[model samples]
Target chain A: MHIGRIDESATLGDSWLHQVSPISKLLAFALVLAAVVLSWNVLVIASITLVLTAVAVSARLKGRLAFSLSAYPALFALIFAFSAATSVLGGAVIVLKAVTAALGAVIVILTTPYPYVFAPLQRVVPGIVGDALLMTYRSLFLLIEKFGNLLTAARLRAGLHAGHPVRSARATTRALGGLLLYSFDLSQRSYDIMRMRGYEGRLRVTLPRSAAPLIDAALVGGALLLAATSLLWRVGWRDLNPYSWIVLAVAALGLAAAAASTWPARGRTS
Target chain B: MSHIHIPDGVLPFWLWAAGWAIALVMVGVAGRVAGRSEARRKVPLVGVVAALMIVSMSSEIVPIAYHVNLSVIGGILLGPALAVIAAFIVEAVLAMLGHGGVTVLGLNTMVIGAEMVLGWALFHAILKVIKPTRAGIGAGIATFLTLAVTTTLVVGIVWIGGGGEAAERETGALDPSTLRFENPFEEGLFEFGLFGDGHGDEDEDAEGERYLSVGRFALVVYTLGPVGWLLEALVTAGIIGYVARVRPRMVFEGALAEEMARIPGDETGGH
Candidate 1:
């Protein structure tokens, strides 16, 4: 039952996370993902997942963020159902790792809009490729809108109750065909507009204005600290694993993140 | 075509990384060959087609744990190069949406891109020689080849991922039969499944591994893959046939566009 866009209400709210630079969030997420992939310990992975979810909460994504986490486990639980008993633990670990990595990423996307996220890439890549990437990003939402409308219309035409499977499939294909033509027309018009503006393949993007380096640095450091702490706890493991120390540290970090996210700050009310 | 519905964190980092690297190369090549206008036109086309793929893949068929990938349709429309890039974008976005795993975006792209590339080549080749109107025949053959490649890819990846002595160390070594869940396929779905008489995997499998070994995985793929191919072939063929009749240029005269002027004296020069 999980449903929410990745960038839901990202630009509307004035959360401190929204003010943080997208690059900082991106770097932090990259670190979190690296930790999730490299670390095989279950407690450490679970703690990282909890820590990121807490950060998401701090970033004001609350239920939708939590919903995304649950979705991963729900999907893997089915695979666990069919696999042999020996593989269940391995599968569970994989599930935890996936949830942790994905939630960490959602934290970035949930806070930053497309403009900020792509601004860095737009600057780094060559003109044509960068512009193409930006164009694709812009067109995504438009396509999504049309797709939703077509689905609703198709459902209505089919009476939303009883349509043969074949008929329903046919309706879907027809809608997609319409979407295809619509997109082609849109592309032509967009190109026309591009030419009218005396445009080359270059698209200019505004950089972030509210650059809160301290707060952004703190967020990145917190994730890195957790990952480092987990890494530290994993060393000399062939002799004996110290799960308790890592667990206590992770719990403390998660709670602190949660409290900070919820704390009342300037220009904000809880 | 076959679609890898498996979530992330299962395949090793090396495998997924390789998948991403190869996919990136393919995208780069596509970009290099494309003209400015062609690439621009493809942006919106890819976006729209990607939306279609996501919608189709996200909707579950449930009974067989299968979903329509629509890679063949994307291939037919966008051709090989753009289809590969579009499929990668679509998979990456789906991964972000928590549909698939981000780690395996590379592998998923490869699988889907392979389907798209093969399907594209086959569709155009088949349509050029055959009556252009009978694109369904081309679509059907292309669909079969696409599925065959993708399914084999999935099986090979699983097998390679599970290889070596460290495999058992990777996962616990418990007897699978000792821990059994309720089998939903007791009566079989639409008379297709691994349940009827006592002639299931256990009867033929020698290793008797707890989870899916290479052999059992292959059997499952072979048994169920045809159904998917048949359905996709029918849909792809129908769509191509319809599009050819209404708008011939979109797909009809792709590989055989030059032949059009010679054979039918039609003058819609291929883009």
Candidate 2:
């Protein structure tokens, strides 16, 4: 909870947590989120949040990264309070569901690198698809940055620091117009860049022979297990959220397996 | 603002499966459309449209605390064929980014597709009637129509989904006579007078049996709906107005332009 310039040195190493496959973390997060959404038990939600917090700590995400990721749920919780006051009791459920799910996702993001995380999805989907997704993500941040630049340029050129609301509107609109032109030009240049790369209609990538088959099996098995468990929950296994406990057990087993594999090195690192 | 936040498995299996099916169908349609037309020629334009949709949806308006999403405006600007493809791709990609739900890709696509097609139709219909001189006015009017249509669809979906849940819960547990209104919050107002009714159904239903009433859910959905619309309208107006001023020909389909050219006073209105 300390504000301003918290240390991030803990995240510097290429430890086992950093080395774990992004796809694995993605699956774990999916399991926790699925469990949270299927059940209404506040206990399960809180427990899962705590569990994810532990994972976050283990992953070594601290300071700004930690705060920015976790603060979303709190923001939604504020909205939920207002919604609860105005409406039915359902708002609380919505908030809880959102928070737990977000916590699960945050754990994955904090544990994994951006490019490596997307690499698996890229392999599963096509190269063109991957390129498209990369473009989309890049474009969002690009738009923000470009918008800021446009505003700054407009201010400099027009010498309009602040003015009447109507004048301000005109200036803003003009800046917006410039942004549109810039965005379009950038998009065209991007298209040309893609063309030069021999992109064709699709992008293709060959997976590494090592671990690829095993990873594929694990992913398929995991998806099937999630689907099956969800169906089971629907068919009268109703309790105060049995799914989260199951997920917790599964997560514990996964960690145990990893720890066992690396038992000899644990004390050495610590 | 109007981002679909429901996680996978929160929805019924049927809902998720249906969404995936719809996504597949759209992909097929897009492929077919791309095959017939010069897709490579339009790739740059599609890229721009995709960028615009992403930017529009991500921009949040202050004080209102809502974000924008204008799949409808994309539909109007890009036309239904390309719009559907863009909407589907956008939702699927955003789902991975955690901005929307993965399972509801189909539903999100459907909702956005509806907005796009309807908005496109509405925008053209309004343009034909008003024939405004200023591109800003036309863009603004078109955006308003798009937002209006999309908002109506959202309200309709929320009401139907929420109403079904409330009815099912009530029939399974409560007295038949007690379930009067579709929305539980409005029902609360009726029963407790000021939400302090000693026998308010909320408390009674708060345990394992408790679920969100259609009315209560509606209140939240509606509360956020306008904010989403306003943000979307502003972004759309800004982008489209910019497009119209710089490249007006890009917006109108050749058919539309030809038809407008045939009409009286078209030259005066034409830029």
Candidate 3:
């Protein structure tokens, strides 16, 4: 799922996006989501997708990983579009809407650590629920690692027979059952440890301070402008044909700048 | 299979919003039910199970193009109260990972939560008539029934969101009594000369419009869904059977504990 890679990028990357506050990134994401939801114009949706793609590139996000992740939603959107029997343009709009929204989320997730993103949400959610969210996020890495090991062991043992569906399902289920038991035990041990450590039904998390307010403000402001343009186009108050081209051109320039920044230095051979 | 794969901005605003509203209320009720001192011990279990669900959902059975939700298994182990919470956690995480629309998180939770609750109920109901050793059979039946019901629910939601106009035009606003499927393909079955009639009309008007109506969508879903359901059911049965045999307490706790105590030399009796 590239979750491991995403986590590494979010925690290790030192890009401008990684420096912005999680709240700002989330706000920008919400703005993009609103833009997608409010507008059905193919050109407008395409513009949003292009802009986000450029943003992801400029933020030093992995382009291939982002596209691969966004492809899932695109596939589902294709099914919905086909079922709706929409015109080619209408179908493109649906696909673009899905891709745009997905790309926006990828950008946010690829830049922000999950805990930092969830810290603000702790205020709105119940203490227990918030704690559970943190616990789940923490447990994911452990379980994913164990799962990978189990699959590898099974493959080595010839326990997974892909040609025989029933046999493979049986083996998979057996592995899963064992994993569930292990997880149940892990949860019990974890609860005991938490109790011993003075867990009072809540986990404390410190929100990262915003160190780049101007950049954060610029990100949110740009998102707001994009959303406003989409809403205007949706209400027929403005024709976005010219604006769409301008946005696309900006996206191209952004990509070029990102590429130039990432290009290797001329004299270094390391 | 029952989870809505509908991307963001497709379903009407009010529909998804209402889904969110109802789901929030349900989560609140579940929290209250599982908030007791005894139930408090299950809090960490909820997190673990939710993480397990996310992991399983990420892996697909490529042959069927399906992912085992494990919600039924989660329900069987965690009970309905904690399972609902787990369902919500799983859906929210998945949405953030871009597996589904963030807007449909609530709807996905409800769909999967219903599966868990229904599967649990059905498992116990079947247990009343069968031996504990056959828990696998009970779980399989429960999984199949739960999946069927939830799949129908998905189709109904899609129809409500304006994907079933052909059926609506003929039957009038979801009137199942008058609903019927029109052949999506206008050409006869043997038009290509595999069987009888080799000659077929090439006229576009005669071929008729081809679009996926609600009925047609249902047809496609039912055709493809049973294979996935059966596969999931078998896997669920196998897992439950293994767990029940090894550590029956994990599967038969709470109310079932007392029932298991009645059986002679049963290890699944007490906490």
Candidate 4:
């Protein structure tokens, strides 16, 4: 439930939310997201994010998911800063609207875990097809990490020795070609492994029934109250951090703790 | 290309809602058919392609004021369903980053979705017929068409939102200014000054009606379409070419792979 770095174990809370159907979370997130985008008032945006933060904390989400979710607002703030510096016209208003809308959506994505989030889609989609799609989506994170590693490795080995345009061109071409070859081989091996595991014409997904009445009510009620309050505030607040700076300070401490815990054994292959 | 920045509180809620409805329907239809097929394996590649688009668009070529979006290539590489999802994430991130307006996310999604759908379908069909010696060219043409059609769609949507229908109604009237009526400002001294003098005169309406017709807006959009389309085409072609030359097998490994293998002339597709 902490707002610092995601702890992977943080989502182990006993809240009724983890029991809800992923479909409900999807619908909740999508609806709230649409509503937020339709609004321009800063207060409403802040209220929605605040409410979602409360729910996420209650869910006790731990790892990267929690950290990533909370980071959405900060990301928006960065964008706003850039736009304000460069833009001549209504930059301030536009930036605030973007931040608020984005924050509202992030709360939804963050509070609901990915596995739980995709559960509803499986039931609606039918069989292994949904499961396959979900698996495919998850695999991307691993694949990207691998690709980044390969690119880094390639950069290091290639060095900075190319002298002329001809050499530089050859080096660049070789590196790209090598990357493509590597990716193709990796994909083929993965596809073969998938086939070996009985992947076929359909993707199957199984979801356990989890949502309780209270959790459903809480999510719906919280979203509505936030939306109502936000609409009433119109557009007055301008400070980027709606929360006191102390909250950020606390979050920083938590991140430091999480990072330190993982540092000693980090990158140690099992 | 100046981002077509639609701020919040500009379009009515129903307009954005309509976009959501259409986007959902498109995703559903695309997902149902594509999800179970062999193409499903390629769907996750949408994320990689989306990342590529973000990097590509961020890197600008001189003389072209607009960043290269190349969403059409994404749609081509990973069909519409996955492409739509990719575009959604990219556009959402871009809007959140204030590269575009947040309120316009729905509209932007629809615009990018159109490019994916139209380009993918057309590219699929074209490759079937022309059977280009180089699969990369097929991808290039498909990307080009999608970008062109999607840009036109954007311009049309903008013109309509700008009150094209109202302008049409005021077309025959004497005053052109009536055709370009601005939405009243919610508050302030400028709002009062603009309307205050009790200037409820009908004669002024006649003069207002004479300017800025729906036809003029259409003309401007149509005129600019080609330039936008060409820029998109060149950028996409360049990127696809780079990908193909670097890793031809990756491009050849999808639904198109079998087709590439069967083609009489080529061996190994690429190095």
Query: Which candidate gets the maximum lDDT versus the true structure?
Result: 3
The C-alpha lDDT values of all candidates are 0.61, 0.52, 0.73, 0.48
- Lowest lDDT sum, 10 consecutive residues, model 4 chain B, at B183-192
lDDT of 2 by residue, A23-92 (tens): 6666666676665555433344444555555555554455356545454444534453444323333445
User: Any idea what lDDT model 4 has?
Assistant: 0.48
CA error at residue B132 for candidate 3, angstroms: 1.0
Error of 1 at A129 (Å): 4.5
Candidate 3, residue A50: lDDT = 75
**Which stretches of candidate 4 lie above 4 Å from their native place?**
A1-31, A34-38, A46-93, A122-133, A157-190, A200-216, A230-270, B1-11, B31-70, B78-109, B117-149, B162-185, B188-239, B242-271
Cα lDDT tens digits for candidate 1, A1-270: 122355555666567788888778877777777666655556667778777667666666666455654465345435432441234444566567666766765666667786676677556433444565556655666666786788799898872335487787777767766665555555555655676787655678886765788998897897688768555533322222333345647666876877675776422853
In terms of docking quality, model 3 is acceptable
Can you tell me which runs of candidate 1 are displaced by over 4 Å?
Answer: A1-5, A69-77, A80-86, A119-129, A206-210, A239-249, A252-270, B1-8, B63-65, B165-227, B254-271
TM-score of 2: 0.70
Error of 3 at B53 (Å): 0.7
On DockQ, the candidate that comes out on top is 3
Instruction: In angstroms, give how far residue B188 of model 1 lies from its true place.
Output: 40
Best by TM-score: 3
Off by over 4 Å in 2: A1-18, A73-90, A109-131, A155-170, A206-270, B5-13, B41-44, B70-73, B165-210, B219-224, B227-231, B254-271
Q: Candidate 2 lDDT, tens digit per residue, B1-271?
A: 3344454433444455666787667655764665465454344444555665665554444455565565545665567766666676677545544455555678787777766766677666766766433545555666666666665665454444333554334312122345332232323222343222224355545333223344554577567766666555665666566666655654555212322333342322332
Clashing pairs in 2: A127-A203, A128-A203, B19-B106, B183-B215
At residue A248, what lDDT does model 1 achieve? 46
